[model samples]
Target: MEKNNRTIVNAWCMYDWANSVHALVIISSIFPVYFSATALGASGTPDTNFFGLQIKSSVLFSYTVSVSFLITASLVPLCTAIADFTGKKKRFMQFFCYTGAISCMLLYFFTKDTLIPSVFLFGLSLIGWSGSIVFYDSYLPEIATEDKFDAYSARGFSLGYLGSVLLLLFNLSMILAPQFYGITEKSVPARISFLTVGLWWILFAQIPFHYLPAGKKKEKRDGNWLFNGFLELKKVYGRLKEQPYLAKFLSAFFIYTMGLRTVMYVATIFGATELKLPSQSLIITVLLIQLVGIAGSYIFAWLSGQIGNIYALMIGVAIWIGICAGAYHTTEAREFDIIACTVGMVMGGIQSLSRSTYAKLIPENVTDTASYFSFYDVTEKLAIVLGTFIYGAVEQMTGSMRNSILALLVIFIIGLLLLYRIPSRKVYHLKLDHREN
Candidate 1:
């Protein structure tokens, strides 16, 4: 209800600085390339046998990601409900952080012969990362006021982009010129990078853990947490049915995230296999994406202040449609680089704005915002499941990824139509009830 404390805000943003290294190094840049290039068998082909079917390595990677998302999507709601009911969100957050960082550290030993364990640990780390975010996002409203939601949301993402890039740049040098660091084996540098990311994730996470509010317990923890959580989700769903705008916004968010996150998840892989970009070149282009993303977060925040949240998101969706089409058409390495840059420019904007917009739109003065955001998280992860699964299945069937890229276009168009139906305003407010609440 008052102005946000500077130290507390910085601490909250710092966790983004900490955990984002995992996102960049493990999920986006280094691991994907490392798995494709160095984690292969004696035969030098990026193919793997799964259940007697031979599949390309990248396809298996996407499928693995889908499985991870499915696991996370299924588990997060009850965890958040337990956190909501018990007021121990900080504990839940810390537990997952440790799990992920430890899982990441174990990746240093991964090789061709260790494929099964590698995939299992990778999925575990994803669950850890996704699980921690359930509570991390709940802290957003606790730290900032309604007016500051968009700006503060943008600030968190900006910090994440900047921090991850700093780590990525340092790690890139080792991967490129391992001899400079006295690394003889080609895979050693990448493995060492994975080790660094794990240490970075764990050590820096303590900042927010020390300062964030332990959420207030609403009810006694005497019942079955899993079953009570389901009740909580059912209650939130009932509330949403009465609020058309929030319901509409979430529906759009769910559909569009299927396209947006799938692209983000698979972009680096596509650049390598489809665009035929080298590992060095792919990481460099990804680096550019992070650099531009810092500005993109602020740019969209300002645009939200100027044009309103819903309209700004529509424009972002339009840009995404172009990006998907462009990716489908562009073949040259340079053209793909341009697509990567465009993605960077709009990616931060859409993600930050979408988050803050939903925060602002939540039922005013509700303490159980975690349940609302849990619904949001579930919507996103499930969308990802469908998107990545479809992407992989289409590639499996048609024997080409070209149609896979085009499929995102249809998804975005649906989201754009949903967004366009909302009434235009200069800005949204917490007073959806017009002071009646």
Candidate 2:
């Protein structure tokens, strides 16, 4: 395998570094709490029940997320396919990355009273973040040798964790240092922190923009581009049926990713609502997870070298089951740290390894990377829909985060079993012909 593209490879990985901050800061960290408590702040008192739901706010959160998933599912693959056909994966990436970053910058306007523009910005940011990932992921196989794929894939995740930690640290400093730093919650520094995330994402992302080689573009349909994009997607749907291992991998990916996503979306909310932890403490714990996550990503990358990618993935899923089960028995903040540490270890590896594995398995079809990876993108989105709502419903019914966490083990277990049923040797053996294109 040729191995001289370090600059290009690292640049590609840094896109994860750039974009994941938005995921950590905007989507995962500040925005959820902001939306729940501040953005949707009612004037005097709020209704406890709406449409037969007691947790009206949580229900709204769940509904908004569901709709986001549907839109992303329908659109993302086509977006990916267009990138593939036009050989514009890089261009598509720049377009969406900026869309997401600009949206994060706009979040500063969302104070107590203004909500719609804020929500709209957040939603568009979600779309941009997700849309960009479709092509960002498709670039994996193009830039790496077979022997290097797992480590390099894991590298992206590791860098992403580091990026998240940097932004989180800066944000934490702003919130904690109002007196010493001349920053206050009601003033510009707090708002500047939000703007900083957008700047971080956009500026650092230009590294990849400069280094990576352009993907090959095929001539699209002779007809209209919109109609052509639809036809290309249908072609992709047919192609998926032709590839058995790819289909199997995707199915397993969907189930396990659902469990992973459920843990991500609900863990903090559970900590704050059920364990009675303060917001400041909950935020600190999450930042700690990001720091620990940097170590975890490299650990799994090394482990995969010794044990192989499939077995490493199995180890990750096994850890998820334990993390969920452990949450059931936890009664204190100390216990929360244990579960959070377990998550930090497995989350990066599972995502990175799964992606590299798929990159290995995809057939040497010319100009179908986006269209194919779109299945990957949409399945990832649907996982959020299934997991969040299921977790929310279980919590609503039992009125216990403990039961909800325990139930998530079923998804991890089933996905693990399905993953084991796939032929591991085939993954390592997959090859592409340079002659195909």
Candidate 3:
């Protein structure tokens, strides 16, 4: 019943802590690195069969991500509509959460031989993780005040970074010291890590699952879900059409974050296949990124207060541009680590600020939080679809992921230009105030 109770807020943030291991272990660190190595045999040919045709494994992995997001983008709006119409947000969130955890556990069986099944399971895990977050993010405006959005968002990310780092350290210990665990095959440790990540996700999620409030009790009898969802989406679009800043910000967010998401998704692949960095070094590098991102989240949240979210995001986007350019020229292990660490510095900050900024932008009176946040997430999934697809396509065509860097750099530049067109904090507030009064 309380609006900003510490207990409720902490419970909400714990969801971030729950699901973040998926980001660290599955998507970012161990899994991508493992996939690349597994696909590239001892002879080191990157080509693998995907349906009778040979496709580069890294590019296939990229397509996997893009496809998962495409499905997520399709499903999110309809799911959110159901959640909002029936006030069953908690139920929908739990469904996705458990689905993702089980999907992740199934990934323990993924090997070079079982590539297709594994890839689909991996896609399912992605869909589940991403879907739950849409419902989770919609809770922000309902639970926290505008002034606290940045702080709460940053804190949530900090907790996620900390929890993910702790789990990753455990997984790394197993991977790096397999003999100590009596593990014979190198792949065993990584496979075990996948199963553990799923269990961890399910375990930590209970804390928030028990504490966060379930929404409206009203039940909808209409079975026309597609039609009903379209109606909800139409309302959301109408609202955005009225708010120029929100619409413009969404555009910029989509463009720049497309590049950002692609880099995060494929950075491990690049390091593994392109830079020829060992898996150990790649995972360690990710750990470093996670550790630094813990601080980055709070740092950018504070910076947002000082200079406004828009300007702070612009600065972060500029840094991302530099990262892409630097990565293009990087050939050594040490140089790649530098680029990765720099990515950490802005990764959390940019993401946290973006979510909070969107929360702050949404008018206070609107109560269909699930539908609104789904629209925001739809933008993200679409961006990721385009970004990862382009990355894969470029790599497949050019025989190198380096060409993808040029594409990402261009995306950041366009996003920054669009961001520049938005009104400053003072002007944005005046506009919001004018609307309110």
Name the top TM-score candidate. 3
Off by over 4 Å in 3: 41-43, 218-223, 426-437
State TM-scores per candidate: 0.95, 0.89, 0.96
Judged by TM-score relative to the true structure, which candidate is superior, 2 or 3?
3
| lDDT against the true structure, each candidate | 0.87, 0.76, 0.92
* Top candidate by lDDT: 3
Candidates ranked by TM-score, best first? 3, 1, 2
Clash totals in order? 0, 0, 0
lDDT of 3 at 282: 95
> For candidate 1, lDDT tens digit of each residue in 24-124?
88888889887776545458676676566678877888888899989988888888898888888889899989999999999999887787788888888
Candidate 3 lDDT for residue 303:
88
State residue 182's C-alpha deviation in candidate 1, in Å. 1.0
Q: Could you list the CA RMSD of all candidates, in the order they appear? A: 2.8, 4.5, 2.4
Q: Which TM-score value belongs to model 2?
A: 0.89
Q: After best superposition, candidate 3 residue 344: deviation in angstroms?
A: 0.5
Q: Which whole-number lDDT from 0 to 100 does residue 78 have in model 1? A: 88
